[model samples]
Target chain A: MTMTNDAQAVLPPVPGLEDDDPPQLTPAQKKRATSRHLAFQGGTAGKLLGYFGMLAAVLLFFVPLYFIVVTSLKTHGDIYSNPISWLPNPFAPENYSYVINEVRFDKYLRNSVIITGILTVVEVSLGVMTAYGLSFLRFPGRNLLFLLVIASLMVPNQITVISNYALVASWGWRNTFQGIIVPLAAVAFGTFLMRNHFLSLPKEIMEAAELDGTGFFRTLFRVVLPMSWPTLVAFTLITVVNEWNQYLWPFLMSDTDAVAPLPIGLTQLQDNEGLTNWGPVMAGTVLTTVPMLIVFLILQKQMIKGLTAGAVKG
Target chain B: MATVEYQQASRIYDPSRPPAVNRVSLTVADGEFLVLVGPSGSGKSTAMRMLAGLEPIDEGTVLIDDVDVSELRARDRDVAMVFQSYALYPNMTARQNMAFALQNAKMPKAEITQQVERAAAMLELEVLLDKKPSQMSGGQRQRVAMGRSIVRNPKVFCMDEPLSNLDAKLRVSTRAQIGSLQRELGVTTVYVTHDQTEAMTMGDRVAVLREGVLQQVDEPTHLYEHPGNTFVAGFIGSPAMTLIDGATVSSDGRALLGPDHGLDMDLPREYAEKTPGQVIVGVRPENWEIVGHGAAPEDGGASMPLTVRLVEKLGGEAFLHCRAQETEGMTASVRGSQLVLRLDHGFKGIEPDTTIHVRPKPRTSVFFHPENEINLEYL
Candidate 1:
């Protein structure tokens, strides 16, 4: 009886406060107001301090990018100069053109585009379906299978290199797109991400569809798939970035210049010229990350939502 | 619309454990509105899900229009359901959500459009058809759910506490809307809710379930006036009916009158015959006519002594909480009217320890067998 009374006592005060005369802000609210005032007020010095802090953080990130851009713009003589100035004077457009027209940079760019594009498409589509199959569909050993896939998360790419090479040699798929592209497909992280994404959807939604006479695949396709776009886009961006800058896997798989992507091509140039063709090397690096940055800006909304959805569940 | 008959339909989740819904046999006539009412984990949801083909039936047959639906897949079964959560497709617009079934069936684009428009108009969602589920309010999303089901025009409409998610005021109005809409469509509908008010007001017949068993199924008035057991007796009414343990005072296969028992009445032979050991008496609040002070015991309208423990004065009628000295543990609700004798006013005037005496409404009084807990209604 006292338990009920205590529960009742906890509830009635809320109603009492609601029904009370216009509330005067208490000391707690005053403290909150004072803290907010300190952050916002204290005149010009506070505003300047806030701006300075932001500027310092921005400079910390921007310095490396500035160094890369300046190195790309300088000539070989300018790069080897005793003192490195913050700015590059007498900038040369020849470095960009030389990397573009003379160094077979176009082939590397084209190869990178094809490999990344094909690999991303494979990874996202297959990952989503695999996730859907494992998450939504019920089969035998589903828990064990998911655990196995999660187990794969801990296995580094190095562990698979020898076994994958043996398989590639047996298939005679070396220097082939299949060898390069297929190995990167069915990534475990993508599968796990989409599975977790599907898991986060309200179970009531599935029950509702079931009661509405929707089939298992229908529910997955109509309800589950449509809501999974944010995850798909995030997975796509991640795979693109991974496949875009790939060096070791591509280098091991493809031997000829025909299939060598930008990373390998730039490494080859570094080996050949050593310190002389630093201009074109820096230029290629700049070119590599520019498209990634551009793509990120376009789909940043979906990426952020997908990333945060796992943490903030329904 | 169709009649649904569940013949020994039992939903046993774990074979070792008891069924969630055990051996439920009931028939819902075509176009009859039936509401299944029970608390959480009472298997009302399990029963609705069984009817919806969301839960598998373990032991019996569910017949829709005399065709067994136990083997049928949910899509082929064609039973539309509106969920409590309103499970609208979050990504699609309201129109698309409503038209999803038709699209899945490979209907023509024009036909799908026409059906979507019709459903949107019927559900009053024409203005909001372009909005996604996230953009719509609770009520609008509920209407969209209704639209999705209405487009299918299934044989029966099963709703699992559809209005439980709405605000109080919206729940009241939506309850009326759903009731009228169910009648208008003339579909055999099975609605589930824990609220007796909803069960009483919206259902043509209300079925009360408890803990995986069907307690009673009857018309609202009949169920209210007559319950099958003590469970139904207490669960059906508000300000729950209080029971005086028959073991405490009953004697010689008969109910003993308290010292202030004004209305001297004998128990009917059925209760006295079966329940000599212990009997549970059931009475609603409105049954009692509050007696005035110093009322004679043997008068035509027999009166018992009572202390007005608490008074709640409503505009037309009021509730008087009276306590009997014989059983200090119990409280009785007496009607508030102009009594022959006046009572004290003001909250400060009433004493917490004061007593009251009142007679039960013997004509409407019911006695239940304490062993089986079955109410023995006098013929």
Candidate 2:
């Protein structure tokens, strides 16, 4: 029989700190005191430094935007004479009117809105459906299908542009809205994001739905979709912005102003009397940036939520 | 209401390993509540899931009202389940959750609302009908889950450890509520739980399983008094029965006391004849009494020397946890030396580390075959 020494079995105190009386301050108290001291003595200086750093960063981002606004308002004479100046010597609202009147701004704006709207709807709805199927359903070759989808993410759009152009030309979809939207409607990132969100949904709730006699599509629409609005809204915002700012496909595919969006339309403002006119181009650019900026301001909350959906539970 | 039957249903998850649920046959009469009770991985839950058509039956058929439903999907089988998580839809109010099945079946909107309201009233959940699951308490969510099932009015209600998530006091009250509710609804419910107390208190009949195999199926009282084997004998009762082996039969068909030869008791003729070599003796804690410290053993009752280990005194009764020391010629047949005796609450003053002599009440001890551990009554 082996008997262990009971006294020895008791855990020993930390090295060199063994004593009957404990430390005066508990660890939490010590932490509070140390933080307080740091806040009073060092934190003020560090906080000031941080504020200045943030100011610098904010200025770095906004200064270019301010320059664009000022340049857009300046006349061509003022732009050529003093390019770096902040103020538009003669605040000309005419540059905007000129870009609007001379170029098909209304047509291009309408095209951009239609393309972006339809693309966002198709992409998000298709993404959610694909994600639900990928995450919830158990079908043969599911892993292989998901692997193929993920593999597609690694293939750059440029490599497929020629083949896609050939296919579209053969389908006679050139210069059509379908040509612009359909080629890039189902994005891999959207699927990946939505799949992760759907996967994180509690499995019990889904099983409960199944036993409740709800069909798969009904469960997805009624149960899964309603709970995932933040992620979906965020994804919608991202897709809207991406499709709104699309340049290469629209530029190459559209043979006329009918299908071209603002990004392609902006090029028309570049030439004026055989010289590149900075004023109208800057004007068109500023107008294009304003819509997205407002969209971002309104939907930043959902965008952040969607981007971080599975990283933390709501 | 309809009768449910599992005709040798089995679920084999993998070909190389043993089946998760071996061919298990059982039946529940119309409106009867049968409990599948066992420890985890014992296939009790699997049996319930197989009945619900959640787990596919690889072998044999499950019949609902004598119609084979082994090939039917969960929804097509028309059975409702209450999950242990109380899986109420987080986004929906309790009323909507209850009405979901009807809504999906394309029932009229007015009828759906009326049915939901009736189920809500029956569960006393009318006040909580507007609240989502996240806003409700655990007991309220459990009631909502039950309401969801009850609204369906299906042939069978499958409950898988639905009360396990509740607090102890709430579990007790809700257990009573569910038992009475099942009786009132008169729906055939197959309840699965690992709690023997729940199995005993709630079910019309309890079926015990071990290692994916059915062990015994009987009324709770019958199961308690006449367990078919050692597993049930030890598993059924709280403070489990203390089983001792190495007891042999004497020439007169009486059991000879351990090695000390201080005790002799007559074995039941059936036990003596079936167990000729070595026999296991089982004594439940309550069947044991501690006579006065030096009281003489009488009337052929068997006594053993016990060293008191611990005492748990509940106001009305005391459980004396003790260890019995093997005497000369007694081989170690029991896995551990620990034993327990029940004493009246007023009988105080049992101290630790003190030796005392205890005897099993006459005719209360049982015998089992040493090899298979089956009760001698069956052997």
Candidate 3:
């Protein structure tokens, strides 16, 4: 009797049981009891701790963005004051215009748009085609080809920069749009992402399309691609962001502001002499960062949905 | 409509392992409904896939309308397939889904819409024509899949366990609907299923397979009454036929069964003449008749003692599960040495663990060869 009482004390009280009754349960009740015992039941204290951790993370990321905006709106005198100002004392809205006129921000913005546009279109199209070939098309040595594609992802871009620069220079493409966009057009990351998504789609649907008299390219464009909107949007956003902030390859390729992107153009705001104006540089940084931020904000939902697809099933 | 023929078609997935579908040859007359039935891994679905051109025919030729189509692509073969999962396009509306094939064939806009609307009306899916697959229920999606095939007017229809996903009640109604619809359209079809009941009820002629080999192909009633082998005998019936092994023919034209010849009865004259040394006897549940409690048979027939194990009362009829009391000389291959007897629904006063005597009705016992398990009547 005493041992039974001790066992009862260790077990949690079941919902519909009387306090005085012995704990004889049906199979369903026993299953519920075992799952309740094994699962983590977060109480009020754990929930509070979770909220506190989320608050800390939000503050950690938000503070640097706050500083960039505040410094971009501050005058040179306010920036160099003995005590740092979290808020601008004299709001200098002229810094944006000054950077736009003096630093040729308009020309840099145009070049950035043109380069990122062409790069994203080419990269995404090539990635979709390559991924479709790897996944759906049958050929000899197909597995070996896919393995090589995955292997290319492991070799860092920095390792290929010097050789790529030499090739571009030999072809007389230096300081040109082709020199910057052509070398980076073949993206292994986008191909890998799209290949996995394509593989997750039901193979029966593809067979159904084939029975409907659709050829290879029609099936890809009509059936396979229409159902792949989320992943396609995600790949496009990633490609745009990557090409927009690309600094190294573009810097190596471009010798002037004529074909350089936003990241390469941002460096021209900094003076070689020590007495450089800090206001316009910060304003130019803001100008370069905001467009990508807007694009991310607009496409953030689809990006997350695409990345998490196939992780859960109904 | 076109007749379909398979001339030793086979599909081998791996070189070292046995074929997924061994060489099978059969013919389906135009407008005939043929069902392929088997257990899992029995290659029923694989055979139908070969007909649909979804699976490669590694060994032989498949001809539709007297044209060899083994080398034809799936689209070129012009066969319509309804997958087990329905396989509807989630992004397209029901109208678009049904009209997809017509649009692919470059039909005019007016004709595509007209055919889609006609199919939707026939399937009672007029309200669902504007909805996507994700917004529809399972039965609705299944109807859309049917409509998709109907609008194509293809040469042959290949259905792979299409009704295996619905609820029990819905499966019954939809199966009836599909049967009547096939007759109305008079299209040649090859259906695949693992349910013996579905195969018996739906197919004009049923084909049974085992271990990637074709076992028997006959009309439903003929297949039931005359099974080619022990596998079909055991697999066809609901409660399954009980097979008793080690029974032998006596010197006086009587068959002796059980330990010490506890049960003996005269065999039919034709069967007794060809009887071998040892044979296996098969008796279905409905053929067993109750005599008395441990009493001699009044009709001068073979009677064996049975101890009741359990009774299942299923409203209209009751089944008594019994263990043969004198199974000492029976071979080990006899399934559990158990006997099943079907009784009327009003059967009363028979409880578990009671001993009773039962006998097979005249001319109801079928014998099989001991080694090969083939029906001796046919031999």
Tens-digit lDDT track for model 3 on A82-126? 889888989998889998988789989999999999999899999
lDDT at B260, model 3: 47
Candidate 2: DockQ? Answer: 0.31
Top TM-score hit: 3
Q: Rate residue A253 of model 3 by lDDT.
A: 90
Off by over 4 Å in 2: A1-60, A75-90, A136-138, A170-172, A271-276, A297-314, B257-260, B264-266, B292-302
Worst 10 residues of 3 chain A by lDDT: A305-314
**Candidate topping DockQ:** 1
Give me the runs in candidate 1 sitting further than 4 Å from their true place: A1-56, A211-218, A274-276, A301-314, B247-254, B257-266, B269-271, B292-317, B320-324, B327-354
For residues B1-379, write the lDDT of model 1, one tens digit per residue: 8999999999988889888999999999999999999888899989988888888899999999999999887767788888888877777788888888787778899988988898787778889989877777889989999989988888999898888888999999999999998888899999999999999999999999988899999999888888888788778876556554443224544454442333443466556667644456666767665444444443456444666656655434445666544333232222232222122232333343354445666676667776687886731
Candidate number with the higher lDDT (1 or 3)? 3
DockQ of each: 0.31, 0.31, 0.30
Worst 10 residues of 1 chain A by lDDT: A1-10
User: What are the RMSD figures for all models against the true structure?
Assistant: 6.7, 6.5, 6.9
Q: Per-residue lDDT for A181-243 in model 2, tens only?
A: 888786688899899988888777787787778888899888888678788887888888999
Pick the winner on TM-score between candidates 1 and 2: 2
User: How accurately is candidate 1 docked according to DockQ?
Assistant: 0.31
The weakest ten consecutive residues by lDDT in model 1 chain B span: B333-342
